[model samples]
Target: MSKEKLFKVAFMNQGKVYELHAREVNQSGLFGFIEIGDFVFDESSGIVIDPSEERLRSEFEGVLSTFVPVHSIIRIDEVKKRGNNKISDLPEGANVTQFPSPIYTPGKGKND
Candidate 1:
C-alpha cells in the first residue's frame, strides 16, 4: 500500500512556539511565506484531552491553508508518524529573534 507523507512544522508565533503536523509543506507562491495544508491532529487520544492542543486546533479550525513567514519558521521535518500538536514557551534566555519587517520604504521619495 502507498503511504501518504507527513511533516512536522515548527514556527514562532506571537512569542510562542507552535509545532504541528500536516500532509503538505512547501514554499509558498506568496513572497516570503511558507504554505501548509492538511493539518493533522491526534485522533487517538479519545479519553485524554490537551487544552493547549485543543487551542491550536480551534485556532486553525475551518482553515484550508495557512502561510507562515519564512523567517518565522524554525524547522520542517518529514516524519514517519504524527506527534501531538502543542504550543510552547521559549526557554529562559532563548536566543531566537523575530524577523524584522519594513526593510524598504517604497514611497517615501527621498524624505525631502
Candidate 2:
C-alpha cells in the first residue's frame, strides 16, 4: 500500500502567519507565486474547539487553489502525518519582514 503525501506550508498574510497542510505545493506559472491545493483540516473529534483553527477553516472553505507570493512564504515541509492547522499572529519581535511592493509612476521616464 502507498501512503498519501502531505505538505505543511507556513506563510504570512495580513500581518498574520497562516499554517496549513495540503496535498500539493508547487511553483506557479504566475511569476513570484506558489500554488497550493487540497487544504486539510482537522475534523471535529471532541467538544474542544479552537477559535483560531475555526477561523482558518472558514477562511479556506471552498477554496480550490491558492496562490501565495513567494516572498510571503515562510517554509514548506513534507511530513509523515498532518498536524493541527491554524492561523497565528506574527510573534512579537519576529525578525521576518514583509516584501515591499515596487512603486510606479504613470508616463514617467526610468531616469526621472
Among the numbered candidates, top TM-score falls to: 1
lDDT leader: 1
RMSD of each: 4.0, 4.2
| Residue range 1-112, candidate 2, lDDT tens digits | 9888899999999888899999999899987799999998888687999888899889989999999998889999999898988888877998777967743446668776
For model 1, what is the C-alpha lDDT against the true structure?
A: 0.91
In model 1, residue pairs whose N, Cα or C atoms come closer than 3 Å (at least 3 residues apart or on different chains), thus clashing, are: none
For candidate 1, lDDT tens digit of each residue in 1-112?
A: 9899999999999999999999999889988899999999977668779998899999999998999998889999999999889999999999887967853457757774
- What value does the lDDT take at residue 96 in candidate 1? 81
Residue 111's lDDT within candidate 2 is 71
Off by over 4 Å in 2: 101-112
Q: What is the TM-score of each candidate against the true structure?
A: 0.85, 0.83
Q: Report how far residue 13 has shifted in candidate 2, in Å.
A: 0.5
The CA lDDT at 38 in model 1 is 96
